[model samples]
Target: MQIASPLINELQCGERLNHAIEHGRRGEFALLLAMLSQDARDMAQFTLGEEGTVDAKLRRQFELPPAQTLVADVADDSLVNNGGEFHELGLRGFALQQALKPEALVTRGPISVTMLDALNNTDPLCKSRYLEPQHPALPEIPHFNDRLSGQLALAQRMAQA
Candidate 1:
């Protein structure tokens, strides 16, 4: 699954924090100390999984109950406003945002192909360091070289007109 950059960064940060806690390295501990205030760490535990022995115990101590496991209940109107209405435009925009899973997009019915095409036409920003540009079909999308050439040609034509 393609994770977003922010999520990837958070995972990396979490791993670093875990490492720091495990090794008890003063420098890493100090860095985390400086970067995260107590309130920030509380928020992190709520959002990202809680890390660090002390932090986890502190979370329990503070009665900052573990975050709910189930997805939050969202209203249908909110879903529609958020582009979940299953229309072509909504699906296209949703695909652009990388919000819809491939299966979910496909199962939504007739607009699936168009949505998939639009998704194919777009490129996801590389998120994780482990991710490689290895998808075989990725090369078919208009690369920067072609896009630049098209823009220049359009500019030249406009200039003449």
Candidate 2:
């Protein structure tokens, strides 16, 4: 009988999580939650940060009960230095290693809570924090209106030309 390394098992768990998010598999997410080690689960929940508040607010507005367990609440800024946005795109391996380092989690705070939240509720069709700006539950910022007007003006100019 062969023994699997803990690191290898964790990596596989992370991969399963990634697949669940990418494919929007709520059932798979549930299974992953069940199978994930407590440490990994804690890391996932810790990463939700501000996103957890956002999720709670939205849930209350919709009359949904407050979430008890982790809900894939992705962190705004943890792995990436890019202004509170997720930057690790298409990272192939080391999902658990990259995601759940205790030192990193403690130092940098929750890095991927949004994905944790996604596992619970795959609705709204935009699970990743990177797409959070488009989530309907989140109100549009005032600057977004100014930016939109500028974009429309630019588009009009191009059309006239």
Candidate 3:
């Protein structure tokens, strides 16, 4: 099965932000962290991996408001950890950034012109789960599943009429 890409937009970010705040208020760390931006997600994962760090850093970030000064001060650094240690970039900061400016996360680097061609050429309906073809091909008659065979035969007769 093909995996659909995650939808991220201003409206979606705003909804997620509100949901995350509710989760934080309820002290649901896992649920709150799940709504974090990619960068914050990575930081949370790394922080959780380190022994004796969650209670002191990441959990506190989850409890605070996104607009708080502590949350707003987190710097967006490279994904890599150079010195074999994880730094706290504040998950609240990431959430605030996402809420205030979702376009930054949506913006991708320069892509090949062929990308647009592929998108334009693709049939959007072909990917739909509920799509029904107007002229469906009849299956082999008198095959397995007697009910389906009878239905196909009736359809074939109807088409000829």
Mind giving the per-residue lDDT tens digits that candidate 2 earns over 1-161?
A: 42232221344574778888899999988866665445443354355555566668789789975343232324533332222223444343345434443113233323344545554464333333334544424433346689899999999999999
For candidate 1, write residues 1-52 as lDDT tens digits. 6434322223347677778888889797776655443334435435544464
**What shift in Å separates residue 64 of candidate 1 from its native position after superposition?**
34
lDDT of 3 at 66: 32
Ranking by TM-score: 1, 2, 3
Cα TM-score per model: 0.20, 0.19, 0.16
RMSD of 2: 21.4
The residue-by-residue lDDT of candidate 3 on 106-144, one tens digit each, is 223222335444444544333221123521322233335
TM-score: which is higher, 1 or 3? 1
Error (Å) of candidate 1 at residue 43 is 0.8
- Candidate 3: where is the Cα deviation over 4 Å? 1-89, 116-161
- Residue pairs in collision within model 3: none
Scored by lDDT, model 1 comes in at 0.49
Estimate candidate 2's alpha-carbon lDDT, on a 0 to 1 scale: 0.49
Candidate 3: Cα lDDT at 131: 24
lDDT of each: 0.49, 0.49, 0.42
